[model samples]
Target: MTEIELNNEYFEWMCQLVCNERYSRRLSYQKLLRHLHNIDFQYMLPMDGNRAEDGIDLRYRFGYEKEYEGSTIASYLDNSPCSVLEMLIALAFRCEEHIMTDPDIGNRMGQWFWNMIVSLGLGSMSDSRFDAAYTDDVISRFMNRKYKRNGEGGLFTVERCKYDMRTVEIWWQMNWYLDSIL
Candidate 1:
């Protein structure tokens, strides 16, 4: 099959997977093979440099590496009449709650999420000249501090708050702000 055809088949499979109701035993290798067989497509299992082990992981790997640079899943989803904001929120929840809890993986996930927001042209308000309007606020909330000047014109620092704060609280605040706008 041509690359485009493979991509379309993959996309359809992803949509089905996302919309599937059954979570338990839904993502097994057999299930994937069955789905592909039903679609008349044969899976060419990856040998090396695949980066991930499963269909979902492969899709995410493609997205993160910008293999689909000009054309993105977010843009496709945005064309729908339904709110794409929910999708973004779901992504945020996964990143912040599930992925970001790990000290090793948290920052990478956060950076990836931020990059996606920036790429979709959803980073800032329509009338604003800034790349993102609420980025500083979000960062401040995440760090649990007020923004302070560092004696530099554009450089600023966060002064840590006295009260102890949890990372989850900060994530929630960021998610809240994102939900309000998008």
Candidate 2:
């Protein structure tokens, strides 16, 4: 299949899994595993086999390992250029309230979201320095403090606080641009 087709399939699969009622609880990880099984996606059980615990799993089923080529979820998120934006859009849609309230993960998600835009060659909509500026702006807005320059000649400036909506707008516009393209 084409890359776009593959990405779309994966995206739909993830959306269905997340939206299922049985898989939508706080103890949802097990539900996710069960959903994966229902969809014929193999997964590795946690080495300890204690499904109640919270941590990474090391013992994956052969099918699951082979399908993903041993890449961790984070690595797949970082490298999958074609579907990264859609994945982020899905995540943002699902976690809208949490994103607005939790600055740390939201900022990181914003950065990754913008980075995906850059990787897709959509950087021309804004200045070349947009990503760094956008990240700094996000930090300042969420922390609710002004940034202070560390040194007169340094390229880096330190933010004393979190970020706000204006900072988020920069990244939002980028996402909007991407949606238009897609």
Candidate 3:
């Protein structure tokens, strides 16, 4: 029996979270993940400090709850490239799946994830039309907080936001997004 590589396992897990039997777009997600991984290596050091915390949170999640390779996210990081954008996407998936559990809502897999991608103006980025330069531009805009005050280019867009999203952390932005949608 061939053993599955941990990085492959993790990527498959991430892919599964957003692409399931009910809603599957495995190839597109893989492309996006690859894109994020490649770009993340360059910006691993947080532009600000908040994303570092988000990366830590994601590391802990993979280490403790999931027990990927006996609770050591460092190994994963060393073995595979993961970015704050990827972590944020994973967190959003977890929130949509676990925290906001409302069966009545019929939340399909990748629903929230795609919502965020679209909100970031990255919905058009697909395997067929994948543009590395454009993707990098969008990611740079997000990391540099070039998004509008209302979060237009960021993960969440709250038109009537109480906080300036450009200056807010992603966690708060996600919260406001979840709040706004409801």
Candidate 1, residue 180: lDDT: 35
Highest-scoring model, TM-score: 3
Kindly indicate the candidate among 1 and 3 with the higher lDDT: 3
For model 2 the TM-score comes to 0.21
lDDT of 1 by residue, 31-94 (tens): 3222222221111222211111222344444456445543454443223321122223235445
Candidate with more favorable, higher TM-score: 2 or 3: 3
How does each model score on TM-score?
0.22, 0.21, 0.74
Candidate 3 lDDT tens digits, 34-90: 777556622322443455445445545555656655434565544444474555555
lDDT of 2 by residue, 1-182 (tens): 44445434444544443333442333223232222222211113232122211112211222153365444433432242222223333333323433333566443333333333333333332332234444434333322323222211111222231323223322333334334433
lDDT of 3 at 26: 40
TM-score for model 1?
0.22
Q: Looking at candidate 1, what is the lDDT of residue 50?
A: 19
TM-score computed on alpha carbons, candidate 3: 0.74
Candidate models: Cα lDDT each = 0.33, 0.31, 0.65
97 in model 3: Cα distance from truth in Å?
Answer: 5.4
Per-residue error (Å), model 3, residue 136: 0.3
